[model samples]
Target chain A: MKKLFFLIGMTFFFSSCEKEGVLTKGSNPIPTINNTAVLKYSGTFVPTSGITVQGNVNIYAQGNKYQLQIENITITDGPDLKVYLSKSDTPSSFVNLGNFKGNGTSVYDIPAQVDVSEYPYVLIHCQQYNHLFAIAELISKQSN
Target chain B: MKNKLKKALLFSTLFILGYTANAQGCSDAGFCSVGNTFKDAQSEIKNSIEIGGVYGVGEEDVTVFSPYAIYTRIFTNRFAMSAKLTATTANGSFGTISNLGDVFVTGNYKFNTGDYDKSKWSGILGVKIPLTASNDKINNFSLPMPYQSSLGTFDVITGLDLAIKKWEFSTAVQIPLNQNKNSYLSQLAPTDKFDSTNLLERKSDVLFRATYKIKTENQKFIFRPNVLFIYHLGKDSFENVFGQRQTIQNSEGLTINGNLITSYRLSEKNYIEASIATPFVVREVRPDGLTRAFTIGLSYKRNF
Candidate 1:
């Protein structure tokens, strides 16, 4: 046991610099959305808008027994969209909207009364700068 | 009263010892490195910063400097026992940092992190080594330093921690118990010995630590933010210098502070780390005279 610990320690010591991710994405989705693509959706859609367009996508996340669902989103002129959720929205720092590989419609089933009161709206911001692009509103409340 | 305190501690011990005698340590390394969530077989924190800063209350002109060394021994899958030995070097009298150089050995067992991570839960039992250094800066920084020391000090530490992803949260308390009253009486004044009935008497410390970090895969660049908190009371709180009321330590209430530690792994054997600590909330007065500074140092790890 001691020998094994020594070997592991030696490896870690020699390889501290060679290591990569400080934290691994626990579980990732398929066809992940390019953070930039999502940020392009502005509530007010227009042709010559500086940001690109991708509209009406579903969002979902189920950690343990809790479930969250974002029905649909629309793009406007710019990449930043603004939507105000109903009074009952639980804001969460680690929110998972659905996957967005190329671009298509996505849906998520929300549990009956999962408490998502914190993050009332989802800010689809550029992944790089994390700038707020599109804002989402919560209209329905449910539990599973 | 002393017996009651002793019995209280002993009962707590038996309840823990009796139930866990058969249980073993946790998975991975021991105690899960209170500052970090990951565990490795061959482990050495080498040097991890205490992320939080401290804000002191009560008294004034009180300043202190203390450094600590702690180690955890993994016993089994569900629990780990540990010990901490520290040396406190003070800069001023009473009003500032009070407790110094307390050598204590404690046993700790963990509980949570049920399935995913098992290193978070922990219960502690330990003792502090006492000293009668009258010249103690905290008591009388002007008097010189304490050479007369007490060998045995019964202290207790109870703590728990939870780590998820990039964050860690924990709280702990250290209480001094059992004593060599004769030891103090022999060196100082007769009335100076243990107050006898004051089992909960004398000195005790309470602290909290929390940290968040982002590490690179190559282990090259790592940044961690943390906080440290301390609360002192009893003989540990009072420092009398040559019949003069020198200072009133961290006796007031709570002190909150934070630290940012950036470490770069230069090579397999040599790593450089810089820690910058800040005092966020000052309950009483502004922090002065001290570094309010950054600690930059290098550490070498060798598997021998």
Candidate 2:
């Protein structure tokens, strides 16, 4: 019985330290952008309903292309969530920036045809429920 | 101030209604009887059944209700078999509810030292079956871990129990045997298969408990006070749709609790028990949604 107890204790000690290898490590590292920012707008996310959503969104114009960068943001987990550059705070008249990933620092491509200056709000909208969880009003940071 | 008064009134009402109980507390296997059930020969009390319910309010405004039925039968004076079925309903203030938790079975072997008339030691082995179906959804997306009933993993439970005089002490370990591929995802695609690499891995847990029971001269009313310490030794891991595993930083921690248990013996064959526990020590990042605060439970048992 003593030996069996010792064996069981040892097994628990070792198994507790067993850590599995993560399949995707550093897979979403921020890419280096060579183009300098010609026009920039920055804002922080504000939660509307449900879980708390907090993050900073930076809209940078690099020559003809634009980038929508979300940094240090934690969003309330939701379904069919999408990121949008909206004309106003509401979900109407918004340019869909595709799916909104979970809270973290990530970047998305912004279409050049869409006027970033006109649509000054970054909205984390739940597409399934047609609800706006959070909104970030972009303010002019710099314009070259 | 109003909420506190309401809470006090609710607790008092529940306490008065609860009279009988088994050892089911916050964690599983509430009683820590190491050597309390030893018999010299085949006794008349060979079979017993207990029915109980537990209510818990955790962090993140989560409420849990668990109702269980347990049956135990002694084959001889030293061997016993027990089976338990538990139904759980978890509700998140964020509007998520899950029902039907896991069902488990346990087998125990008792051993006594000195004489059969004295207290003895025993070992318990058990397995939990996660046959509960989890289909809870919110806004067309599968509910997160907090609103789901089961971890969807098969777990093994092993423990030791000792009862001597007025004191009872026991320790137990529960470990998951495999990672369960969870179908619940926040933003899963329609084409995504249920067998996707999205998995939930649970960590092993160690529980230590001690209880002292004081009975009246006639033994009609029993008062048992106990303390429980539970350590989550394993890290809860989550595998995303991309098959990348991330350790949920908040799911592993230590909890220390103390509770007063009371029982009333209505007759020789029937009894009632109840317990209320509050956590005095908590060290860990609590998993999102599921919060742990106080627990109340009541049970009725009959022996034949």
Candidate 3:
């Protein structure tokens, strides 16, 4: 009986130690942009203290609809990271673009209700830990 | 016996009237079914085994099926113990996942009421043990609580039940001892309609149930209709990306459900039961993902 109990205990222990799922780094290609797509604003990513980030962010307007694009970007991989269009560098008042795909040239559609002009800064943040990884202050192409 | 039956009927009518007049709502995370709280009323057998399963549609139209087994041993007329194990399978847009759920070990003590036929009271204490860490994931993304088999917290459960003839009334509470290590972030699964469950901290819950039983002339068949109320003690909390705890608003509220169970005795020691339950009221937010639109179950019991 003791041996049988020990065997059952060991089996349970090993089963409980099964591997958990882990996220891996990947890349996505930038969306196609035609001549009709005009640049509205652009900025370069600036890393937070002790972090590494290199990227250029651009907002384009095709008619009234808008899209945000990140090009040639390299960022520190983190858990639950997201891209945000924020009123300030902090994520207090912001619209979540979605999860930040690693080292990506990726595109995100801006909601029609969101006034991009009011959201002057773009951020890469860890939503779970509330850590800011990178910030980019948009400069309007028309203003420049 | 005639007087006892009349008193039970009167009490049952009064209780139903009061319940309907001042009723709220709530949900269950497993404590309500522990021990002998809802088992076949006091049997003369010293030992028994039960096997059962439930099928239900949960949050976001996820189909959930759970199969369980329970073993009970009566040490004396006053004391008994039960152990239950359950396994769950959930299928939804995210995918299919199945695993061993939680184990509940409960001890029940029937109080000495000199007149056992008039009224009997029992107290129950139990502990829920999780079989898996609540971090099951699909495609490297953590699945929400609805998809995971276990809530992944050690919980203490305690309750009291009073039975008078054909009516039974019970109240119970379940308290979590620790937070689960689930790291589900809604942002990662933008298309899914689930809330963030990262390191979810569930609040305590209290529940009350009133059941009335009816039996056939031969006593071969029994039917019970129950009204259940559960209240989440407070808002649940979850750890954010910044490693700070944030309250999940609207997580605490009441849910009310109506349940009907029918049982048939195949022999002196063998029985079968079928049950159906539906929620009449639900909380605004249920981040812990225990919501069920409806549940239907069947079980077999054998007494020795």
Candidate 4:
């Protein structure tokens, strides 16, 4: 009986160990730009203090709706990364676009309720750890 | 013998606590086991205490361990009351979380049938109260419902059970009193493939179960095979980031499960039971996070 109990205990101990998920590079191809689409804001990605990042970010006005696009991007891989449109360089008071599709061109649909003028910074952030990887300060292409 | 029983009870409790396992996919929302649903009908005990543990794997390979205790008091031959407390711990790629799950208080009233040996009928009423807020978070990001310990709603449960010789049939309904404050949006973690449970308003669930019992010649062992069906009355809804209520498509449907229970009498006042359940059919979307691939449990019951 003791040996049986020991075996059961060992089986549970081994089975209870959590399996870690492997993070793989993901891709989201850029969408085709229509004639109705107009460039509203553009920015270039800048790495945070110790992070490496390079990309061009653009916000396009398609009729009343808006779309944010990241092109030719490369960044340090991390867990639970998210794309956010923030009012400031920091992630506080932000509209989450979605999870970051690693190292590629991706387009995210901005909610109609979100006003681009109010959120001037596009941020790449690790949502799980609350760490900022890169920031892009949006410059108004219409104003230029 | 008394000392041996005490030691056995202590050992079982310790084993359950240390197992770190998971629980059922009945999708009951707290009504299926309300009042004498799975109790032994022939036992003459007026009161009893039960300790049990269940283990299962849910969506996204999330492992869940649920340990529960139940206390019952029979006021008369016709009336009885029971209270159950459950605690849950979930571990997965997201993280590990532990919390008190829910509490259920239920009453059962057996009605006199013309012939007691031929048939018996009982009415059940119960209430479920959430112990956790159902909004547990990790690093400010809200964990999905799979990680939540409770469904986070006050619910009213009503049911009826009828027993005829070796066959029993029961039907029950659970209605949530209010929406939960959970703010987990799966879109924020798209790779996880979890559904949004943000400010979720769940629909009511109706359950029906049929069981057949078989007893050994010596009456020392009993076996029960049960079939359970649950249907969501309507589509559940959740709040979007834009503060709009959106219905989770295909969230309203039916789930059918097959369960087998075996019980052994250790003595006049002691019994041990083991059960296993697997789904035969499942809904397309289980945003509530009660989707279990399978479940197995063991319990010890002491009667007085």
Candidate 5:
């Protein structure tokens, strides 16, 4: 019984234990994530819809140095609003604000920073969801 | 008042930037596989829907639109089989070649020599069953080719795929292996002079293809543009329309083609691919460039 116990211990030591965290094990011992959600929006391009909320925006940018800036504030006819962060967003530790547009206009098309280092948290709730449509992301500018 | 304004602007800026930088988060309904097997299968399915054909343009202009679908099932790290179905329309203004269609099923086996950071080699085998009929239009009448066109003339295809890091290399060949058809000769003759046995000898062909790929998203997405060179081997076992001894070298020469493909994974079960092939000469077997043609097509897929 002692010999069998020792052999069993060795068996478990060498198997597929090395690739534990990376590759999935068992019949389907896959990794699980808790805070992921689906997002979908459609617009016909009505001048950034006035609000201009964007996610998955692919633009060209550098570190958190604030290399580029866009001000889309067309203060048209909308209510006064405020922006806040939610903690559930993963992948990014924290989010940063670039700047506001249309200091005093009929509509508001706020411009945000293109750097990913600072704007990590991607959750933004708005009392105004219809006006904001697209999110701009800074892509690499090396190639055309 | 100063602090309130700064904070308000700060929050607004973060909110906008954060939303714009949103990646295809894991929470979406679709799934994109990260492993090698999944990536390969993803490329194949996406490839099936591409809309470009080599033999589409006639000697002077594009005659028809060519479309095809490919399906592949991966069984192991190095083994899989694929089925391709295709259809090509007729270019009437040019010559006589009419609508063409085919259905092919083949198996593939790959060998992995590289490890977590190495290269691998893959081989593929498949048979073509020409499901589409072969017809040549004469005025209002449809004149069928003497031999059955599609599956009846089973064509076997084979190829090898090699990959080192993000760069991949592959080559494939196809050979027809079915009985020869001789009805066309019979049509030319009244009866006694028609020899059914002496119809088609040069049906066998060999196609060579190569590809260059740019892998991204840690190899999850790949952009591989490829080129194909095809040569119809041997010679027509039969004779020319004039019943004279003539070498149809022009019709039986080699062909060249190319395509650029973009493939992405939405989720494990869902993936999308797109591609375009430039104008290529089809039916080099024709005596004149007037008979040359090209093809293009695309497909969509969901893993069950």
Candidate 6:
């Protein structure tokens, strides 16, 4: 048994780098929406205390897919933060976009099952502590 | 008044001891591993080896396949030593990663109580060494907690096992001895500004199990049905994907499981054992990337 363990240890030690699916710090480019997309609604971010958060949220429609583009975003870095489209800053009513990638321009696809038309707010929330960091309420840009 | 109080206390202690003696080990592996009685072959066989595989499937299309080996040696009638090693491969929506898992070494001491039942008790002490760093990542996103092969912490485990007649009862506790500093905050993008220290804190776990064994008429086979209850005292803390240190919610929960354990003796020196366990209740919230619903395993044991 000791000999078998020793053999296994030597094998792993020699082949550590050769192991498949090892974690790497590879880069994943931020997703982008097409230029042909039409802007449906837009909003300016409302900052909350503790972080200077400012950004423009543009909801664009291209065929059947809707893209939520966050532009010129600046927020003090936070832990466990996430982006969401919701009726309020609370998570129960929110549709999770994903974890905050960083303070920058990024686009996320709206799932087909989600009705972005009804959820008018974009919220930055700390999922670990359930703290709302910032919120942006979308308003119609069209001249009614 | 003093005599009455003494009598009350004595009665309570007796009742509690009687209750505990009726409960035995379970299949959770956490408790059952330390609390098991491998029978009276301890004097005849110097060593026993076990090889097995476990598979688990859960929500979000996550799956885990683990193959493991165990070696145990009885140094004397009252003393034994055991070690286990495992490798795990996990795959799901988060991607795939495979690596060596935790390694454990344990020492046990067996003694007898001078009573009518002549019951036996075993005390166990062990340690789990991390074989893989818990902060493993995929494409720069720290792989969710479940994808990591090791919990990234050394754990101290201790427990007690009791055997009387055809019943066995066991309980054990596993506590992390150190914080894993390599837990990278994957939720935060690399560009995100956050604290430099990314540590993951794990909670302690407790298990209680009881089993009743029924032997065949010829005594060549044995069937043991067991029930296990596990509690995760969920105070797990880690830097979130957003780079904030906080406790992961829905982590604390209780699970109840039923297991059917069967062993068939091929000879005096060899046996085949199979066990299937299904969780009847899950009461806590698990992380987004990992889920555990059922576990199954089979192993061959050989004594030398």
Q: What share of the true interface contacts does candidate 2 keep?
A: 0.00
Give the CAPRI class of candidate 1: incorrect
DockQ of each: 0.00, 0.02, 0.08, 0.06, 0.00, 0.07
lDDT per residue as tens, model 4, A1-144? 345335434433443222222221123233455677999999999999889998999999988889998989999987667788998999777887866767878788888888889999999987546699999999999963
Sorted by lDDT (best first), the order is 4, 3, 6, 2, 5, 1
Candidate 6 lDDT by residue in tens digits, B1-304: 9999999999956744542333222222533456553564635888988777666654445566666777888888778888887766777655676777778888888876434377878888898898865655555355555666666679998988888888888888988887664434433334322222246776777878788889999878899898877777875676543334677676677767677788899888888888766666664554322245555677777788
The model with the greatest DockQ is 3
lDDT score, candidate 1, position B218: 81
What lDDT is reached at residue A46 by model 1? 20
| lDDT of model 1 at position B105 | 51
TM-score of chain A of each: 0.33, 0.74, 0.78, 0.78, 0.26, 0.77
Comparing 1 and 4 on TM-score, the stronger one: 4
Residue lDDT tens for model 2, B68-165: 66667888777888877665565553354535556677788877544524676888888888754243443333544545556566888888887777
Q: Which digits, one per residue and each the tens of the lDDT, describe model 1 over residues B1-304?
A: 9999999999956644442332211110011123232232134433221111122111122222333334445455444444443333232222222333344454545565454344355455544555432222112111212111121245556666666677667777666565322111111211221111101124454667787878889878888877766544443222121112223343335545556667776655344556544444433411111222222222222211
| Chain B vs. true chain B: TM-score per candidate | 0.50, 0.79, 0.88, 0.88, 0.62, 0.80
Tens-place lDDT per residue, model 6, A1-144, is 576556556634432321224233333455688989989889988877777888888998888788898898999877666678887655557666665667779887777767777888988886545688888889876653
For candidate 6, the lDDT comes to 0.68
lDDT for B192 (candidate 5):
26
- The Cα local distance difference test for each model comes to 0.36, 0.64, 0.77, 0.77, 0.38, 0.68
Give the TM-score ranking, best first: 4, 3, 6, 2, 5, 1
lDDT of 3 by residue, B124-213 (tens): 999999986687765445678888888889999999998888888989999999888687767545344888888899999888889888
User: In model 4, where do residues sit more than 4 Å from their true spots?
Assistant: A1-114, A118-144, B1-29, B41-44, B113-116
Candidate 6, position B262, lDDT: 86
True contacts kept of each: 0.00, 0.00, 0.01, 0.04, 0.00, 0.07
lDDT of 2 by residue, A1-144 (tens): 345335434432332111111211233243444467654888999999566977899887777888888889998887667788888988777766656756788676776677778888988886545678899999998754
Prediction RMSDs, each to the true structure = 26.9, 16.0, 9.4, 11.1, 31.6, 14.4
- Per-residue lDDT over A1-144 for candidate 5, one digit per residue giving the tens place of the 0 to 100 score: 344335433432322111111111233232121233211111111223445432232122222222222233333333212221212232122232211222321111113432233342222222222123223333333432
Candidate 2 to truth, TM: 0.58
